[model samples]
Structure formats: C-alpha cells, structure tokens
Target: MALCEARLEEKARFLCRGRNPSDATDLLQDTYERAFRAFHTYDRNAPPLPWLASILTRRFLDMCRQDKRHPQQQLTESLDVPSEEAGPAEVWAGYTLEDVWRAVDLLPEEFRDVVRLKDMEGLAYAEISQRLGIPAMTVGTRLFRARKKLKELLLKKAETGGAS
Candidate 1:
C-alpha cells in the first residue's frame, strides 16, 4: 500500500501522457480507488509500482473502449438552436463518423496504429513512442502523415460520393 501510494502521481502521469486534461483527475482517482479495492488480490512478491501502473493502464484502456462503443452525443437540453443565419455548421460536417472510421481503416497498418493512438485514444507522442518502442519524433511524423493520408482519403470519398 505504501509503495502504491508513493507512485500514484507518477502512474497518473503515465496514464495521462496523451489524454485530455479533463480526464486526468478522473483517471487518477479511479486508479487509486481500484487499487485499494483490489489490495487483497495483489501478490506480495511482485513489484508494487509496476502492479499499480498496470492497473492504471487497464483503466485507461477500458475508458477508451467504452467511449468508442458508446460515443457521447451533444446535449440540446440547455441551449436554443441558433437561426440558420447564425453560422454554418462545423467544417468537418461534410464527413460522417462512419466515413471517418472507414478512411482511418484504409490507412496502412503502421499509420493506422499511430492514428488510433494519437487521434482516437488521445495518447501523447511520448507515450505512443514508449508503447510502440519507437522514438517520439517517429510518433509525431507518423501521426502527421496519417492525418494527411486520412484527409486525402476522405476528400476522395467526398468527391466520389462514397462517404457513408
């Protein structure tokens, strides 16, 4: 317990490497709460820090999976819809979520991983590099190229009336 407590902040930071700022607090809290609940299941012989880190990682992955499966929709409960003259919709309105998913899937395997980690999983380049065993610069470069390829694919789909 002492060992796990000492590494709480570090573990949280590790989990937050590429995620949204708003999620940091929740991730940290969840990690601690879970570790506390599972304390009895921990192996005394194994290193505690690593075990705690594993818990944090699992929690983060679970969140990502849940978010993917049930994406949150914008709530209209608090605001009136603006008149048509107010403004045009967002630029990405031309592409549906399914279209974006298909375009990402069409990317090469390597590029697809980078896109999924950085864009979908919201991982930081350093964290992605660490996970993939590549340099941070490589992660950045791959993400940039992946985005470019995805955009090109989406544009082509739009032109061909293939966007779903």
Candidate 2:
C-alpha cells in the first residue's frame, strides 16, 4: 500500500502513454485496486513500479478494446467529409493509434523501452541512456533495431490484412 501510494503518479503517467490523458486518474485508481487484489501473486524480488506499470498497460489495452466496441460519436466527424479542396493525395488504409501501439508493445522490452522513450516520449538518445543507465550508443542501436522490427511487423500486417 505504501509503495502504491508513493508511485501512483509515476504509474499514472506511464499509463497515459497508451491511454487518454484525461483518464489517467481513473486508470491509476483502477491500477491500484487491481494491484491490491493481485498483491499475493507479486514477487517480492521484483521491482514494484514496472510490475504496476505492466498491469496498467494491460488495463489500458482493455479500455482501448472497450472503446472500440462502443465508439463515441465525434462532433467534428461531419467536418471530415471529403471536400472539393481536398487534393487527391495518396491515401493509405488507416491504422488506429491502438494498432501502432500494439505493434510497439509486441517489441522486446529493451527495444520497446528505447522506442517509447525516443519516439513516443520524444526523448533524445543521451537522455534515454542517462535515464535508463545505459550507453548512448546502446540507446541508438536498440532504437534502430526496434524501428526495423516495427516496420517489418507493420508491413506484414498490411500484407496479410490483419488487425494490427
């Protein structure tokens, strides 16, 4: 409980990586409750924050699935109808943010962390290395590998017409 209280804000911010910013608070509370219920299963040797963050990540994915099933009507949807002024630009099939993140989530942990920090959070290699206690070169290398793997995954998804 004390650990949960101490890391609540940090976990919420992490959850916001894959969730609506406004829903962070509710998601954080949900994380706490779920964590408490699963406390007995927690490994004492494992670090708490990452474990909590993983739980929140799963919760965020669940919420995303839920939202997709019951999509909200957008007020700006009517404005999005194709207009005469819209040029015939090449239009690729749309992939939701969930699709992109789901691919990212499929990445190996070391690759995923650097990709998220550098690409999603917009951190520099030096900053990511410093925060993660790794070499800057390592950060760059991992990010490169991560992007390559992501591209492969997306390409495969496109080719197979799979839900990403």
Candidate 3:
C-alpha cells in the first residue's frame, strides 16, 4: 500500500499525460482504489507496474466513454486541417515537445494508444501488445499509421505558417 501510494503521482501522470490535470487526478485516485481492492488477486511474480498501468488504461478509457469525448470529433477536426506547403525548416521552427504531444493527443484512440505506448512509454512492440491487449502485428500497423498522421499534421502546421 505504501509502495502504491508512493507511485500514485507517477501513475496518474502517465494515465493522464494529454488530459486535464483534474481528470488525471480523478483517474489516479480511482486507479489506486481499484488496485488496492484487487491487490489480493494480483500475481506477486508478475510485473506490478505494467499490471497497474493496464488497469489504469482501462479505467481511463471507461472515463472517456462515460464523458462522451468522442474520438470521431478529434479525427474530423484533424482531417479538416489543410496540409502545409512549407519545407522542413519552417515546419520544425516552433516544434516543441508539448506541441508534438498535443498532436499525438489529436490522434484517434487506437493510433494514439500505440503512439503513447511506443514513443512516450518506450515499450517494445511485444510489451505494447500485452499492455494494449492487441496483437503485435496490430501494434506495428497502428504505429505506422500514427506516425504517418503525425507527419501530415506537422506538415499542415508548417504550411499554414502556424509552426512557430
């Protein structure tokens, strides 16, 4: 319990990286409560962090669904943005990591999960599959598509003179 409490903030931040801080806090608390209640069921030999992460991820997804924050809305908004015609220099001028993360947040849930697992979390493909409960091949496909979409988005930003 003390160990879980110590890691609460880190887990919350991981679960809510692109979300409102308040939402993150709520989810984190819920995750801890859930984890504590189910701690007895957890296999002692298995990796606790990943198990906790998986639980939190599912909880977060449920929250999103309950809140009715449709991924389709984000997808529509992203698709509406016109691509930029500028070169790489103009495209990367104001490209802070936060901006990149915001772009990642705009991705559809499936693609966004892959990007977060692979890029932000630095998990291997196999690990990502286990965490996401998807096949390894699906992880690869989602990652490829997510990268392509992010590239397109950044290019659009550059072309629209909004890169900076």
Write candidate 1's Cα lDDT for 1-164 as tens digits.
77666576666666666444446678878987998999999998997888778888899898767655543221110011223432233324555666677777999998998877766666767889999999999988897788668767765765676755
Whole-model Cα lDDT per candidate? Answer: 0.68, 0.67, 0.71
State, as a TM-score between 0 and 1, how close model 1 is to the true structure: 0.45
After superposing candidate 3, which stretches have Cα over 4 Å from the reference?
A: 1-86
lDDT of 3 by residue, 68-151 (tens): 444433332333333453344434545766677788888999999998776665567899999999999999899888978887
| TM-scores, each model vs. reference | 0.45, 0.43, 0.46
What's the best-to-worst order under lDDT? 3, 1, 2
lDDT for 88 in candidate 2 is 19
How many angstroms is residue 15 displaced in model 1 relative to the true structure, after the best TM-score fit?
Answer: 22
Task: Give every collision pair in model 2.
Answer: none
Window of ten residues with lowest summed lDDT in model 1: 72-81
Best by lDDT: 3
Name the runs in model 2 displaced over 4 angstroms: 1-92
lDDT of 2: 0.67
